[model samples]
Target: MPVVLLRLQEATGSGEGGFTPFSINTGLIFWTIVVFLVLLGLLWRFGWPAILKSVEDRERRIQQQLEEAERARVEAQRLLEEHRRMAATAKAEAQELIAKAKAVAEKERAALLAKAREEYDELLKRARKDIQEEREKAILALRREAVDLSIAAASKLLEAQLDTETNRRLVTEYLATLEQQR
Candidate 1:
C-alpha cells in the first residue's frame, strides 16, 4: 500500500497528467488486507479444528471395521477346518463298519458250511446202516429157502425110506461142503 501511494505521487508530479487513468487507492488496499487476515484467523480458530476432528473420527471407524472383518475371516477358516476333520472321521467310521459287516458275513458262511457238512455225514451214515440191515435180512431168507428145497429133494430120492432126522443130518452135511467150496 505504501508502494502504491509512492507510485501515485510520482505519476501526479509528471507534467501532462490530469487525474491519471491508472491510479492505486492506498486505503482500499489496506482495508482489503485487513478483511482477508480476519477471515483467515476465524477459519484457523474454529473451522480447521472441526474438519480435523471429523477426519480423525472417520479414520478410527474404518480401522475398527477392518479389524472386525479380519476376525470374521479367521472364524470362517476355523470352521472349514473343523468340518474337514469331521468328514474324515466319518469316512473312517464308515469304512470300519463295512469291514465289520464283511467279517460277520464270512463267519456266518463258515458256520453254514460246517453245518451242511455235518448233515451230509449224518445222512450218509444212516444210508449205510439201512443197507447193511437189508443185506442181512436177504441172506437169512435165501438160507431158509435153500434148506427147504434140499429137504424136499432128499425126501424124494429116499422114496419114503429115510426118517426125518437122517434126512436133516445129510442136508446139514451137504450145506457144510458147499460152504467150504465157496
Candidate 2:
C-alpha cells in the first residue's frame, strides 16, 4: 500500500511543492475535461437508462402496494359495517322475543287470577246454600217442640185423657191460622 502511495505522489510531482488542489495546468485540465466528457457520455448511453428504469419500476411497485392497502382498508370497513348491522338485527330479534314472552306470561297470569276468583265465588255460593238449609231445619225443630208442650198442657187442664192424634191436628190448625194473621 505504501509503494502504491509513493508512486502516485511521484507521478503527481508532489515532491516539487506538495499537491495544490487549485493549481492550473492547461494539459492536465484538457485531459481531465476529455476524461469527464467520455465518462458522462458512457453514463448517458448505458448507466442512466438502467438507473432510470429501476427507479421507475420501484415507484410503480410502491404505488401498487399503496392501492392494495387502500382496497384492503375499504374491504375491512365494509365488513365492520356488515357485522354491526347483523348485531343490531340480532338485538332487535332478542328484544322482540322478550316482549312476546312477557305478553304470554301476562296473559297466563290474568287467566290464573280469573280462575281463582271463580273458585272463590263458587265456594261462597255453596256456603250460603248450606246456611239456608240449616236455618230451615232449626225452625222445624222448634215448631215440633212447641206442639208437644201445648198438647201436654191441654191434657192437664182437662183432667182427662184425649185422643192424641185429634189434639195434634187441632193444635196444628190453630198454629197455621196464627201464622196467616201475622
Best by TM-score: 1
Clashing pairs in 2: none
The per-candidate count of clashes, in order, stands at 0, 0
State every prediction's TM-score relative to the real structure: 0.45, 0.42
70 in model 1: Cα distance from truth in Å? 3.8
Residue by residue across 118-143, what tens digits does model 1's lDDT show? 89998989889888888888888888
Give the lowest summed-lDDT range of ten residues in model 1: 15-24
**Candidate of highest lDDT:** 2
Clashing pairs in 1: none
lDDT per model vs. reference = 0.85, 0.86
Candidate 2 residue 140 C-alpha distance from true site, Å: 3.8
* Residue lDDT tens for model 2, 31-130: 9999999999999999899999999999999999999999999999999999999999999999999999999999999999999999999998888988
Residue 113 error, candidate 1, Å: 2.1
Model 2 stretches with alpha carbons more than 4 Å out: 1-75, 143-182
